[model samples]
Target: MEKFKTLGGSEGSTFFFSVERQKKWERLDGPIGAFVRVMPWRHFGRKNLGYLFAILHGADFFFDFDDDNYIKVDESTGKPVEILPSTTVLDNVMVAMSGPTAFNHHPMMKPSIPAPSWARGFPWEYIKDEATEGEPAFSQSIPFVSKLNSIGVIHEGATNVLVPKHAYSPYNAQASIHTQPALWATLLPTTVPGRVSDIWRSYFAQCIFADSNLRLVFSPPKIEQIRNDHDILADFAAENDLYTKSGKLIDFLSSWDSEHLHFPQRVEQLWIDLYERSYIELDDVVALQKWLEALITMGYKFPELKPRFRNVALMGQFNFADFPNSMTQIMMWSQKMRERFQTTIAAAPLNKTQLAYLETHRIDAIPARDLKLRKRDHLGFYNPLSNLMRTLLRFENSSTIEAVLYAHDDALLNLTELSEGKYPFPTDKIANRIKGELSNAAFVDLRTMPDRAKARTLSHRVFPNGTISDIDKTIFVNTSSELKKQIPSLHAKYKQWGHYYCAPGQQQMAMDPEFAMYLDPDGSAWFPFHTQSDFLIVPTKYAKPFTEAATMHLKHFIWIECAFGKIVDILQQQLQAPTRLVKLCTGFGDRRGRWDVINNHDCQSESVAVFHPFKIRGRFDEFWAHADEINFPAYSSRGKN
Candidate 1:
């Protein structure tokens, strides 16, 4: 440890001892701490760990050496020397890895030895002379060539090197240096005895690496293993499963189409496929899931684990006194160093253009008044338009109207009102009303009307110009049915018009042929529109057309919905256009005028809204509730619609 510390001098090297005093270990603020928190220490003992730790610590490569192993020394000089393969041998192995082929021959094999020898997990079927020796089988090299040093290349030969495409079994965990490409190679199936875990993991990793067109090199042994105090029988028992099923497992993994899946997903699917093929039990699947989840939670972004280490050159030397003895003090010093370095970086002056760009794109600087205006415009247009349409289409008079409203009763009334309305609008009353009055109605819920309308509003925001012409225009129709029919036609007529249509009750808009059709006509695209109200249209230039924006918005909405409003506001500011709220309908209950009443009602019922989803009773009751109080900020009575 002292030698390593000296050699790594101020290079940000960290060591974790397998001591009981884990709490005493400081330096938990960065990625290293995050990794230690999620490590499966209970399952794999400290002796067989650190692959994940290396990744978290941003190591370019990690060297694994067993305690039982020692570096070989020259008798004359008493100096250590790595036992590397000859150039000829490495060249032969290289030929094999260059093609789609698997080699069962061990690098330790000797031609002169008249006895048969095999690596621990080498398949018995390929143990014969022809399979083990002679001309090396070949396959096409990976189409994508990495810079010589960029990829995880294995160096073991004295003068020659080989990158084997297919990794044979018995790639021992000890005396190996794993680079970033093979970082996803995790020791899974913790229930399996420790003896075979590394072997199986290697096979699984090899299969994955091959899918990514990566090669695993088998080099000459660098260290000699000193025999440890272990019973041969016990070791054999632990390795019994590998002897029986290693080949079968390899074949099973090879069959998977990993080209289409991400590394993590591929790992998951591999375990599932294994279970489906009756190779592993359900418990194995569960264990695999836990391992994969731990990897994800530990912040392992596989296949693209880019090195993000900041190299800080040392100026002054550090003595024992400089390193704090107390863990808390050490942590504080480290944190202060980090903050100081950040401050230094932040203090660097930006050029005028960069400063201007930052100012233009700054979202926090957006005035509260502008945000309120935007919200008001959104609400004013959509609320009345949707309400008028519902009323005119006779949707409110439908037999199923009461039933629909009852289903979304929480959205209509607060908890107190819900409790009271139950007696008057019972199940029978709602059902009868639905069957009689709403039988032929569109059956659109008033609660979701805002979101539905917002979908269209978002479409307009993405493509400001009327679809048929570049000029902005607004046309109002008399009835709800006419508005619905004409909206799609109007969008179709305008070359630049795009429609943001969401299916009734959906949280967001759909990406379908119709959406594409609307986008293709005007080269307009969809942007993510989170609100249900479809009234306000901002004539602004967007970074992308409606189609691209809609696709991006859809993707973003899946991850988080709150960012939608922020993104829209950013676009509004960028376009530098007046955001107009065009009124399409009138005579619906004055939503703008009732802002105070709605705001007061919302504030009082905030708690009920939070707990309503948990207390929902009916099948669609949860969907019917307008939990916007929880989803959005309180409606301010100060904003004018």
Candidate 2:
């Protein structure tokens, strides 16, 4: 510990002892304490003690050692001994690092000592090939080297270094140095027992390292293991999965096409693919995502060795004065530049113009002080629009609306139906009764058009003689999917016709052809001008493609609200048309009073009498008795009949 602290110096090593961790670490306040608090494995007990410590400290190089491992000593002098000779060559080779290389199973006690034993996690299949009967001899011939990278492998006085097309591993964690590039590979699957975690992680790391063209050197053993107390049977049981599935897992991973994906994305995809193949359970993928998130949160950028351009420029010497002062000239010049330079030039030190360009383009490079001010200014503009949209989209039955409109009432009245005098308001009867009254009106029941045949039949009524001028006024009621397909054609023909639509709520209105007209429903009197009694006049010229797009797929409420609101803006801004509000019956059959507050409003007074006595399952008996007192104006009184 003292030597490590000295070696680390100002970098400061951290020690996480298993016993009384929280009590001991609680005293470490501020950044270090906060770091410990958020560690994913803080509550994992001692299952991942070293990994947790490594992540918390943001270690660049981590040397993992078991408690049972120690430095080898000379038996004659009883002094610590060095394993590797000074003559050992250090370099990387691809062929030597390849997948089929046999595992080194020589006993750690001494290279000259013969042993039949294999390492604990080593696969049983490789025991005969890798194990030797006598001391391992050194090769006198120098190994071939490639120019790719320096990766040296020393085992029993022999060294071979060659870059390989593929790599495999039975690497142990007892004494291993994990470099920064391979830190993501050290994430052990928490679902697996502790015994196999290191072995699996090693295999995963080898894959990652091989993909990155990084070296994995196997040197002579540096540390000797003083065997710890453990049940060999229990250890074997824990390692059972690896023995059975390690080769299969490796083969599965090797078959995947991960060359195009970024390193982090590749790692994440690997886990997901493994889960899909049922190699590892879903819990393993979840753990991988958590680890990846933690790695990103810790600000570790996945290292990409390939160099990339930091900036782009147009390098050719050309005179801008040669072209005419027109958009065509500018476009032509840009095209020629693109064709000549292929859109990018090698990055060089920034010149004055490049620096100025960067200053203008780098919006995200704002300083912290300016960022706060920008956010404050941004909210100043954003909040009011957000609040206004929220208020406009709020349903009539919303508690917030009821709270404001009926604040004085101890118990808010739940208006159940459209009412008149002490007689049951026969809304369905009035529509038939006023057929003579609405002689000039054309009523198209959009709801009845459930199929294209019915939709085409209704279309002829709305657009008589295949032209809009043939109709004086058209009313589309209860819009549905069949009606939606006919709207675009109807709207295209009826450029001047006064089209009106009525529905219960915004969701229903959203399906209608006039949704965009309700943006500033209360503020702009333009909306009310299109109103005739209960129906809101649809300006077919201004109606957007509402039902055409699948808006129900928008899962979040705010998104739907914002999207509809944006549609309203586009209509108002692009079409420059007026929108109006009108009284319409939305809750006809809502007998349970679910839509009572929305339906039973004073606004119902402005509804067209021709479509009065709105039938709602004949449920609002109380409302019908007091219907006349509700002050519903006759269509004739509004001068629209």
TM-score of each: 0.38, 0.36
Q: Which candidate's TM-score is highest?
A: 1
Model 2, span 289-315: residue lDDT tens: 666765675567565422111111222
Off by over 4 Å in 2: 1-14, 17-49, 55-58, 73-122, 125-165, 305-641
- Each prediction's number of clashing residue pairs: 35, 23
**Candidate 2 — what's its lDDT?**
0.37
The window of 10 residues in a row where model 2 has the poorest summed lDDT is: 403-412
Q: What is the C-alpha lDDT of each candidate?
A: 0.37, 0.37
The TM-score, computed over Cα atoms with residue i paired to residue i, of candidate 2 is 0.36
* Global Cα RMSD, each model: 25.4, 28.9
**lDDT (tens digit, per residue) of candidate 1 on 1-641:** 23222222334455654443333222344333433444345654333235544554556565666778887887888898744323222333323311112345444335345546556676666566343332232322321223222234353322123333333445656666666656666444554677776666667666666544344665556678897899999998978877788777766654444323456777777777767876556666665565555566556656631110112110110111112222222122222122111110111012344334323322001111223322333322222222222222332233322211211111222322221222222222111111122222111222234544433433322232322211122433332234446465332322321222222101232233333433423443333323322111111123133224334333322221222232343343344322211111111244432223334432443232212112112212122123222222232212222
